[model samples]
Target: MSLRTSFAAHRRTRARLREERAFERLLARAPTVESAHELRALATRR
Candidate 1:
């Protein structure tokens, strides 16, 4: 594999990890059952 390809892969992995952490934080403070359901739907779409 090329260096550029590896770097791109690493960047994508980091972004996905960041998004997952943000989503977890959202779940933690979701507020209401309806919102939690909405989160679930969003999660499934991902």
Candidate 2:
């Protein structure tokens, strides 16, 4: 692959990891059923 393509792939991977971490944090902090459901929907969308 070209350098540009490789860089783009790496960026996407990093973004995915960030999203997973954010989701985990949200689950940890979610104290209500509504918030947990919202977080689950958001994660499923991605």
The reply for model 2, stretches above 4 Å from the true place, is 32-38
Query: Per-candidate TM vs. native?
Result: 0.80, 0.71
Candidate 1: C-alpha lDDT: 0.93
lDDT of all predictions, in order shown? Answer: 0.93, 0.91
Question: Can you write out model 2's per-residue Cα lDDT over 1-46, one digit (the tens) per residue?
Answer: 9999999999999998998898889898999989999989877887
* Model 1 residue 4 CA deviation in Å: 0.7
Which run of 10 residues does model 1 get worst, by summed lDDT?
A: 33-42
Model 1: per-residue Cα lDDT at residue 16 = 95
Top model by lDDT, which number? 1
Superpose all Cα atoms of candidate 2 onto the true structure and report the RMSD in Å to 1 decimal: 2.0
For 1-46, candidate 1 gives per-residue lDDT tens digits of: 8999999999999999999899889988999979988998989996
- Model 1 clash count equals 0
Those runs of model 1 whose alpha carbons end farther than 4 Å from true positions after fitting are none
As a TM-score, model 1 comes out at: 0.80
